[model samples]
Target: MDTNDKHYRNPEAVLDLYERPPLATWPLLSLQHLFSMFGATVLVPLLVGLDPSIALFSSGIGTILHILITKGRIPAYMSSSFSFIVPSVALMKTAGYAGVAQGTIAVGLVYLVVATIVGIAGSGWIDRALPPIVVGPIVIVIGLSVASSAADNAMMNGKHYDLTYFGVAIFTLLVTVLFNMYLKGFWSNIAILLGIVCGYVLSVALGIVDFSKVISTPWLKLPAFEFPYISYTPKKIYWDAILSFAPIAFVTMAEHLGHIMVLDELTHRNFFKNPGLHRTLAGDGTASIFAGLVGGPPITSYGENIGVMAVNKIFSVYVIIGAAVFAALFGFVGKLSALIQTIPGPVIGGISFILFGVIASSGLRILVDNKVDFNRKRNLMIASVILVIGIGNAYLQIGSFQFTGIGVATVMGILLNLILPREALSEE
Candidate 1:
């Protein structure tokens, strides 16, 4: 496969078609990819007390806008990440959703800070401090800390308060695992979606779902649109946005490196050398900025989709572009949002159980891949401190600013990795 094949040759020569993907090849790839991420794309809005429909539309629009800004050179989709869920939900409660939205807009500005730093200092500075030691544990905490929440929701029932939902959630989890472990072709690619469908059908049979909300939602409704309003007032939360969203780039950047590694393996090409780290960081940062600008969550290069691409052997960037186009169009449609809403909480909650677990597992995998030493006293000390501080929500207070949970753990890991004796390095 030549790296540069043009899609939709135009007389005017618009749409640079990075790597020159064909015009006609986008729909199925795009639609399938869109559906794959639908359950997740609108989740941020729903969690943060924003209109889910608006979130869907914005996510799609933000994605396309990011691609356009980058000239469609990167094969990635932006969606809602759960890392912001706690802070967003908290912001919505303490301040109004509008306040949280304002904070999110400021969060986008944080991306510009990252982009600027990367543009000037480059990714090397970041790469040194945040190697697998620091990043791996933080990623693990990202998933494990939420493990209880997903399971609790999955098992909750308003009816009798029995463990029935737990059963359903477990069944779905098993199906997803079995599919990924044994299934091949398209079936393997959509293990999560298939698991959700099976869980949904079962829940409906059990009388767990209520479609009343879907019925009440208007078919031709317009999504609420609000642009980010810049403000200088203290109540506007310009500082809180920086505190909540800035640290997230550390997590996202690590994931980006893993995605690049995945791409390199899939295409048998050196994505690092060709597009180079510079181009990829530029693309990821651009996507994140658009995400924050439109009151959506930050966009990270998702490992799940990258796994799908690897499994299906789909190397064309057009597929991702197709996915972005479909997402943007679907965002504008009210019924689509309504239908997504109809997805029972148990169903999504059930999947979240597995998804969150996998995230933590991925972090562990990073450590294992790096051969981190667990037996050494120094290594164990650092790792133990990270797990305890992160999972325990230990924080170090400095005046008004507080660092806790993943942030505290991340900083500690970096310090240990740098200042600790060589014997402290894990030999796993």
Candidate 2:
């Protein structure tokens, strides 16, 4: 039969795969993709003391929603965003978990607004508004802002720098690095998971792990789901929290565009032109809203899954669909959720140390890759001010509302980029 005739008989066969691999390969491929994103997805919820199961479930639903929204064209997985970690933690302290959810929903709304604008106009304005000068520092702040939290966790909630916990953290970090750098194929992809397992074992031997919760937990139970609006009333709403966290969406929006660009290079397809920025942004925004409603972390495109696709040469959207199914299914197992919660604080801390550092480094790479002129007075002024504001946790209050650290820095960077004269931006 001709290629066209064969494709007609099996519509899925002709989609993106070079050749339709066997059904047996699908699960394994899906699992690989899941493994790649597993560490980061679980870490976000763990950091904020949320249910990892809910995050996993929300991510699966969000990924599926994104696929449906984009007509299954773009190959991306939606998962908890680290960008929300610092703000979510801060907001949770003042506004409570419900407040965090409300703020997150506000951020998702921002995405919808931006998506609407992109739908009407093109993505050019997004680039103009958030040049590398603006985005690079914001990304750095997103990571650096939380650096102390990692250290605090490593010290067992700031008790002190005990050698035992520090030792465990270092071991986990080394294991993850070794697996990622030296391993090949499947082993390499699961480096982070393997590192966690090794760290968990060490923690157990050191008598740090608490298994009582795991034993008491049921094997099968529904996820602990919470609704944002229903859980909190207007009187309890922290408008300041909403204002502070919502603008982070602008950072993630730029990140979404970067992810699409990476996918385009990996798949050799112009996803931006095909799925179009509007569809992708809208899909992401909708997914984030869903996640927020369920009291899960905000969703963003998974770079880990993108890395999986790049390594395996598998670009099939169905693989991501299968992974999403697995994630959602795992969310229903109460024992699995309990087990995740049982993970020692130090183990999370160690992994986070690496993860947060990687985030900061990625920001640096963005500036380097884009050839951003740091020597220029304009760039230096913008970057330096952002770093100070974010790292110093400089908080600005207007009435009852407040902008903290990253929020204030992000606004400053954007405004500076816009207000600075071009001629004054000359190279040093």
Candidates in order: C-alpha RMSD to true structure: 6.7, 6.6
Per-model TM-score on C-alpha atoms: 0.73, 0.71
The candidate that wins on lDDT is 2
For model 1, residues 1-428, the per-residue Cα lDDT tens digits are 44433343222222223433345544654555665566666666776777666566656666666555555555666666655676777766776555555545554555556556656665555456656666667667766765666666677765444577878888877887787679876566556667777987998898877787768877677666555554222355545655766665555554555555545434544444444566666666665556555556666555445544543445556777667666666666666657765666567666776666666666687788788877777667677877888778776555434455666776777788778776633444
- What lDDT, from 0 to 1, does candidate 2 have? 0.74
The residue ranges of model 1 lying beyond 4 angstroms of the native Cα positions read: 1-43, 65-76, 80-102, 158-161, 228-322, 395-404, 424-428
Candidate 1, 322: how far from true, in Å? 4.1
TM-score of candidate 2 against the unseen true structure:
0.71
- How does candidate 1 fare on TM-score? 0.73
Off by over 4 Å in 2: 1-55, 71-110, 157-160, 224-276, 292-323, 399-404, 425-428
396, model 2: CA deviation in Å? 3.7
lDDT of 2 at 98: 76
The per-residue C-alpha lDDT of model 1 at residue 13 equals 20
